[model samples]
Target: MPPIPTPLTLTQLLNPPSRDGLLTQIVSMLSGLGFSATDWETDSDGRIILQVEAQTLADLWQAVYKIAQGGYLDTATGDWLTLLAQSQYQLTRNPPTQTIGEFRLTAAGGVGPYTFNKGDLVVTYFDPTQNNKALIYRSTNAAPVVVNPGTTRSIQVTADSPGSAYNIAPGSVLVLNTPRPGLTVDNQGTLQPAVATGAILNGPFFTAGQTLIVTSALNGGAAVGPTTFTFTADYPDMTSVANALNVLIAASPQAGRITANVLNGALSLSTILITGATAVDQITIANTGTANISVGFDTGSATSVSGAYSWISEYGQDNESDTSLITRCINKWATIGTGTKAAFISWATSADPDVQKVAVYSNLFNGTPKAGAVTLYIAGIGAFDIVSGPVHANNVYAYIFPKLPIMTELFVAPAARNTKDVVFTAKIKTQYNNDTTKNAVFNAVQNLFFRLTIGETLYKDQVIAAIITIPGIVDATLSAPGIVSDIVPAINELITLGSVTPNWLVVV
Candidate 1:
């Protein structure tokens, strides 16, 4: 039998040199240039790797790296040195994104014509001292707004901060204010339907000399004086009378910020910027009509007030980060080819910009199907886009589901390990702690098991080993059913942990 030939080191490669290939020659050249080289896992391409030593690692790596990069060595030879410096130079690229946040404004004063000037809104929160994070929004083209009176509008604003997008805590108060030159109000007056057919006062019969006084209050502005509109003719149709009153409000200088239209044979009034919470109060509708004229939707025959105003809070997110973008770029590169289930799963779980958790199964779990059918269950913040179209790039028999059923089961506490003693700090002594070590363990284990493609073993000892790292955890054990030595799942099934009780985190 022929004896195995010995491998050449950096020293041997440069000496009395026999024909030993380009790798040796490359190392010999690097040696002359005051750089050390070592053979680290040879490939079809002869790439000479630098040894991991303090002096040569930094100074020599830098000097020899310049030599390789001086265009002396081939491209393949430089790649090995490049890999060695991976820790120094990150390959991640920044992504182009805008930080998007929103404020939900709900208008009151029933069936309104709420006008929100695009540039009128100013929102401030999340460490107000850091004023750079404040978000301001307004109408783009016009001073007033185009909006449905009786609805909620979500105003999206682009915000910026020193670093990444600001993650505002949920339920944080979104203090909203406006400084536009207009009175904001929640004062509203709705028209009652017609009861009869007539040219004036059509809905209800109004005798001659009848009167309705319209009054409004402004937000941080002057009080709008009441305007009186009287019927000139006797027993006129509701339309003519309502029209006359609308004309009266529209023409009056005091009613400059108010408008009235005859809706369903009754007068419907809308105040400009006045809101209920700001000021806009004392909205009285007086009926000075003779012979008891009927007012529609008015609690009584004389006066009525507007409803109270309210608002809801919502959160916004900042733009993508450099790290997240690099992860996405790599994932996109990974999924560019034939869209196999594995490729799709990789994109969904790790690559797709939005997806965070995913599980892919070949066999049927939700419903029965052919042997080759594939199903994917995924979840994340706005991760529905991945499944909006096709599940796989090329496969036609794949189905995507929104949420997979969470498998819930209790695991008994591990048996007391009397042989060994473990010690942890007081923080992890509680069943559940703010430190989140337990949650981290649960998530890590879940990631290993709850995946699209299954056939992985869940070892009880592995979980126990993870939990033991928490502070104040003296000891831990794994009992049967909940967790044993190991449990192998079927190709179609995925395991999810529902909860872990305090009894399970035992100490001997």
Candidate 2:
């Protein structure tokens, strides 16, 4: 094998064999290029200084020389220095950066140009109930207030100030991600009011000696008494009896819990308005009476209230820090034209902070061409758009395709937001006897799944290891998939443990 090639760096080129000796080597490298290193020094700040002799006959030379005097290297020199700097930056840096993910935006019950201001927040998560606590970001652009109608352009922004670091992975759920500082124009927000149901009795009204039983158990509902209704005196018309029964049920102890009314000579029951934390479920009505009375939803039905908002369109990016840029520059140099499964995966995961998992399969699925086609399967945390604007399919192709040898074709697979289940069953023994202990164990199991990425492996041992780390879980065993093995999926498959089912008991 050929000897490993050492990088040509200023530090190495200026080796202290004597200042004259180093200057001679630099001059030799620049001799034919019309540039020469004349003098060098180390500043009090520890920055190395090098004075270069350049041919300044043209306007380009004049411009470059002036810029170089401002402490920045000339374009040619800067490019070379960047290449050298990247070689060493790998070991020191390489932290992930948040990507400018793309998403769609549409008006559900409103008009056009749903505008948002700078610092408008948006979020993605594995769970929806936890609000403003997921991967939160803000809009960087704030102009023309009335933006266009399409995908909302947004960048991953943090509330973090300088000197601190924050990171988020790609393939994070971008679709349906809640946009903060919601659209205030035209009263468009992220939430909508809940509606109640009103149903009519299609069958005949209550007859004499007939009884009706009502039970409420819908949407965290309470139990309504199975009240019996009977006619006091002989009645020619039963409509008044239905009205009387409606009044009776309406005035019952379950008034705020539920309500009943008579509409169009039919008994109408509706769920009363509850607080945001509470909701109403379907009520059960049984007829123990002799007459048959049919019941169903009325003309205007009550629906559980919900909120809707616009999708994200376009995309934006946060400003990359100097360290990140330098790391990227180095990666570009090291992996240029290097296309392989491993190389591509590394390149993609490093492409942006948001990209959590990646799978690349060559000639796996064929279409037009018989062979030489490679597809990259990428997934993020919550959601993200793969093809749009700068970070689209073509950009991905450039990163992987060029790296592959000639005659091999590369294609970026269509972005898939769906997640596959990585199920597991565990039995745990806890030391504590408190009610919260069991909950804590379950939470620990779920947390393991939440931390899993798209292409990450779900090892049985790792699961048990995680359980043992918890305070209450003294001993745990894998019960479901008894054999210990890794959940290794293909490159294109994005899998997640939706939930963990555990059979646990407290120990004395």
Candidate 3:
């Protein structure tokens, strides 16, 4: 039989005598040296001057033990652990990063080129689960500001603070708190305006050569322009001018279904062009003609209801935990080569705060392993697809390219998601209501899936334990997963949470 090795801490390995034994020895030696207990005051532990002497010696031994422990990865604690990571691998704790989202702005029937400036504020609704706290996001200077030739514009916003809590769903942040009236966040889909629609232009005919310029949404939107008839006939009346412009538009084969009308000196230009296309037609009266008059085209007011939706570009991350930091620091040991698999994993994770999981493989395209060929499969905080995923792939490639080993073929890709349905039937204790207990069971299932790493297996036993251990669930059986043992994913796949179907109402 082989012998089992005993565990040893630095303090234990030193074989230092007990504090009590040391105290007793000190007291005995002092007594022999003719010192009396009355000479030194006694503490609550019933020791005299001997106690202080014994404790000081014990502390010295512990100091030596801690110093030795600090030099090793397995035994170091707190700030000492941080120092080892810093000095050895140049690694610091990962800081939390803020999420960047694209917030769009729209105004119905408005003027040209509206600007939503940098530092504009947008916020999420107060969530009850977060103690009624609302997250704020601000527009960066890089956000687009021009609304020229169109009434809708999109802008970029950064979360006010760094944290995963700000990685909210699309359309969740609709409050543009920057005080821009009539400009909205993510409701542009509701406006439902027709094709080639233009806001009414308030005007009486200005001059002999005044003309309206029309741009179509057909055949790549060729412009239809300057009427050939009755140069001054429509002058001095807005309705006459609109009717005249309508004639010119009708004369052009391009403006097939376009219409123009005037009411109270406002000329409205619109087209019922083709249904189902959701048009982008423009009715700007061009000032390029011989008429010396100013022109203002008003597209109707539009809220962002239809035009605005935000998705996380760079997902925010929570501060790294001690365990994750320690694991990374250990991986740094393998990164000294800059070409090892560990190096790839370490650098890929460090590429972005949102990169939560990374899977590394050699020559995934070929069945046989090819030397120096590596592909990294990584996932962001939420909703990253490989073929059409966000910038996580770009961010990773940019970061890892320069750091790669010479002549090594490296490919970085977002991990493909493997979504699965969570279904279960459970027996519940009568004292606990089925609805509340069923919800708890689903939460347990979600938690299990949530904690799973990329490419990890989902075991049936784990599911059983999770549900059965719940306070109200007496037992549970898995269903609809096609197997009762375990669900496994490909090496390049990540398990994403899907729909949950819990049939907990049945008594059995």
The TM-score leader among the candidates is 3
**Native-referenced Cα lDDT, model 3:** 0.56
Models 1 onward score TM values of 0.30, 0.34, 0.51
Candidate lDDT values, in order: 0.37, 0.40, 0.56
The residue ranges of model 3 lying beyond 4 angstroms of the native Cα positions read: 1-22, 31-46, 52-65, 96-319, 365-371, 380-389, 434-440, 479-486, 506-508
lDDT of 2 by residue, 1-508 (tens): 1111276444333322333444355456665567533333434221132212112123333453434432322222333334444454332233333433223244433345566555553544332222223444455553623444433333323322221111221212332344323322110111111112122223344355655455554344456565454444333343555565566566665556555444333343444544442222334444343332323221111111111111222222334344444544444545644655656765765655445445666663211222675556554432233223124333455555556777775545323222222233433444454334444444454456446654466677776776677665677776532224666643333433322345555564
lDDT of 3 by residue, 438-492 (tens): 5456546655765677678988788789778877777778787423667777555
When 2 and 3 are scored with TM-score, the better candidate is 3
Off by over 4 Å in 1: 1-96, 99-101, 106-114, 117-119, 127-153, 160-164, 167-170, 177-342, 348-352, 365-369, 379-508
Task: Arrange candidates, best TM-score first.
Answer: 3, 2, 1
Best by lDDT: 3
